[model samples]
Target chain A: MADQKDGNDRKTTVLEDLKGLKEVVKVKTQEQVEELKKPQETQLYRSIFRIKHDEEPRNRALSTLNNLFFHIHPAKVNRDATRYGYTWGLGGITFYLFIVLVFTGVMLMFYYHPTKVQAFRDILYLENDVPFGRLLRNMHRWAAHLMVMAVWLHMFRVFMSGSYKRPREFNWCVGVLLMVLTLLLSFTGYLLPDDQLGFWAVTVGTNMARATPLLGHQGPFGPQLGMTPYNDVRFALLGGSIVDANALLRAYIWHCIAIPLIASVFMGVHFWRVRKDGGISGPSPVMLESEAKN
Target chain B: MFGDWHQLWVIISTPDNIPIVAMLGLVPFFTWFAFHNMLANDRLIAQLEADPQLARTHHRTTYPYNSRWERELHTNPFLMRKELLAAIIITIILMVWALTLNAPLEEPANASVTMNPAKAPWYFLGLQEMLEYFDPWIAGVLVPTLIIIGLMAIPYIDANPLGNGYYTYHQRRHAVWTFLIGFEAIWLVLVCIGTFIRGPGFMWYWPTQTWDPDRVEFNVNRNLDQILGINGSWISHILPTAWRPEAAIIARALWGIIPMVVYGVLAALFIHWICKRSAYSRKIYSKMSIIQTVTMYIFLITMLFVPVTIFLRLVFRIKYIWETPWFSI
Candidate 1:
């Protein structure tokens, strides 16, 4: 009788233990659900974004100012500056095309080999074998061409708007350098395919280097200065007398690395100066000829 | 004629030539768009200038304005949105372009096989076209360098303060006309000529004419000195026998220099006359420093030289205006 009483007592204790455990689990799960419901309140989200994305003007301004990439832009811009008719967005388009070029160019670099024998074959293989390789190459080429056109138009627009006047003059000079770099970038990339078109085109191009005054073998007084096919500006440019394997490698490096680096530096200065020089040169209050300071 | 059209189509349809083809349309459209805005702004300026009361209260832009509205907008939503839209549109266009047209890849580069009428990439074709008129040193090297310098010099040389941040043809007439003539009439036109006109052997072919690789024309090019019958031997007549050879070179160089100097002086006088033509222009000209005026004259004269040389080449068949053993211009 005593043993049966002990067993009943033990059973009651076990049931009580199980119920206590279930209650604790239920409360903990509820807490977790409450936490997930307010994800914006989470530490991770707060750490990355820094500011809440609300409809407040402060947040809107912070969104541009705090971001790494978007910081290139000012928090607020002139209402007229946003108009499509004013800037035609050519400068921005040129920059966008440059970004496109860099992306596609990097992808292209994976398939290309800058050697005489393999260079042409690699392009062939890319066109035929690799997935979307032709698309990559086409995008790069077309974007490059588009970029050149855009740069020219940007300069044209700037000139027409008189945006290069006053304190903006230095920026204009930087812009001119950027334009030159853009052309150089395109010219260097042109020789990478190593096809007949590129070969002849580059040959014709580098041939002109042979006529660089005081540097080229065939230029005025170049011979008198000891310039020759073996050692002259053209030789220095191509790494030899002709556009061959070395020229291919040289062009590859310049197109991929050197000019891009230089261009990026110039572009940084150009943008910074634009802000320093008082934003996009207007569609501001037009100054009359009578108001002109003599 | 139909075959000629086909031939032209073949050239235009080539994948590499596509950019130049696009340029033909885009350049003219943008130019027209710019001029249209410029003229509208000019009319507005005229209206504003006529009435002081209206000028005092005017918003000064072509777009409609309201007093209640803010002068500025948040870049995040306004400018950024447009930029995003532009980026998306350009991406779509690029994607479509990539999908539809395959990038050109000709037979592997063969040094042994030269491309008939070998051309540089389309952008450099203007320089190549200039090669027909000037020596490689002048056309290929010097002109390109000068163009870069001239572009950089514009802001410094432009002393007129009338059209500081806006487009008004009347206010900045000289600047606008100079740029238009330099960019549209010369650079873009030369690019067109290089792309469409030059054919096999780099010879000029009318749009309707078929490119015949074997066609040859008589060479009628003559140097300026030769055209004037100023022989080196004739010039050597006044010098001792020992100094005769050197004197001939000196004489020829002097002859070349004379015409060049004459052209320069004439171009400068014309530019000066134009600058002083109007009362407003004179007011602006008076604002310029001596350095600015001279720099402007140099650039304007150099710019005019391109067309002058082109005319001489095409019409007069003159090869070299300034020719020496070392260099020819």
Candidate 2:
């Protein structure tokens, strides 16, 4: 009878151990739920975001100010500036298209070869065999065309709103240079496909460079200046007398590396000047002719 | 008529030509949209100007502004949200465009075989079209340089401070109109012509006309000196025997220069007249420095030269107004 009682005691001890394990698991799970409830308090989230995202006015401003990408924008803007009618969002759209171009352009570069023998065949292979290759090429080409149109429209909007006036004058000049760079970028990319359309188009384009005054072989006084097909500006442009293999390679370098770097530098100056010129030239109070200082 | 329509369809439907086709709709719509907002702002300005009390108290923008609401909004959610939406919309449009249309890849670049209507990309078409009226140096190099300089010079040259931030046609009529003429009447129109009108041989064809490679135009084009029957023989009589050989060249050069000089003077005077037309415009002109005035005249006359040369080419069939051994205008 004493042995049976001891066995009963052992059974109760095991049951109590199992119950304690269940309680521990439940309490741990609850603690985790509590921790997840305020994810902003987590070290990982804190380290990355740095600021708590909240409905407070300070946080709202901090959100823009603290972020590297968003910091290009001023924390506060004229309420009227948000209206589509004033700015038409053209400038922003152009910048976004550029970003899109860079992304897709990088992807395209992975598959393309700059040499004459390989360039055409690469394009064909990209279109036929590689998944989403056609879409990638189409996006790059169309986005390029879109970017040109956007640049024009942005200029138009700025002109219409007279945003180019005053302290913004130098910025406008920078913008003009950027516009030229944009066109050059598009033009260089035109020859990359190495197809008949691109080849002929680039041929005609460089042909005009042959007529650049003082620098071109066929231009006015060019021959007098001792310019020739071998040494004129066009030769320098194409890396040779004609749009051959070297021309293809030169175009690739310009389109991919050189111009983009230069353009990015100019773009940095353009945006910086915009801020220094007192944010966007405003949807501010219209000054009357009678109120003119001069 | 059906056949002609089909030819136009082919041109318009070409994958590469799609951007120019899209431009037809986009340019006009945006232009109208700009004018519409500009007109509204002008009306508001007029209203506020008439009422001194209202002018003092009124919010200047066309957008609704409640005094109780914040004058400035945080860029994070307020502006960034709209920007995000715009980016999304643009992405959708781009995706659709990429899926629907295939980028053109004309049979691998053959150097031996040339495209009958070989053309520059659509954006440079304006410059290419200018080649028809001017020398390549002028059209391709000088003009593009001038355009860039002229555009950059605008802010400095414009003296009127009335329309700085907002859109208003009344206060800045001259600036607005000049930009419209330059961008719309000249640049955009020339691009359209280059894309739609020029066919095989880069010859002018109506929108519906077939691109016949063999078609030839018989009209004889002449220079201004040729048409006027001016020659070196007459000038040689007035010169010494030693200068006789160069008389024809000098005469042709003079003929070209004289008219251009007259045109330049006339155009300058016209611009001056316009600038001084209204009380407000005169006020604006008076504010401009001498340097600004001269720079303005240079760009204005050059801009006017484009249309004048086109007129001479198309209507009078005159090739070069000023012809020399080296260069011709």
iRMS, all models: 0.9, 0.9
Query: What tens-digit string does per-residue lDDT give for candidate 1 at B1-329?
Result: 33489778878988878988998899889889888888889988999999989999998888889999999999999999899999999999999999999998888888999998899888889999998889888898999999999999999999888777787788888999999999889998898899989998889988867898998988899989889977677668888889786875777777999899999999999999989988889998998899998899999999999999999999999998987778878
- The CAPRI classification for model 1 reads as medium
Which model scores highest in DockQ? 2
Candidate 2, residue A118: the lDDT equals 96
* Top lDDT model: 2
Best candidate (score: TM-score): 2
lDDT of 1 at B206: 83
User: Which residue pairs overlap in candidate 2's backbone?
Assistant: none
Alpha carbon lDDT at B197, candidate 2: 92
Where in model 1 is the C-alpha error above 4 Å?
A1-39, B1-3, B232-234, B245-248
Q: Give me the runs in candidate 2 sitting further than 4 Å from their true place.
A: A1-25, B1-3
TM-score per candidate for chain A alone: 0.90, 0.92
DockQ in order: 0.74, 0.75
| lDDT for each residue of candidate 1 in A109-183, tens digit (9 for 90 to 100) | 888889887998999888899999999999999999999999999999999999999989999999999999999
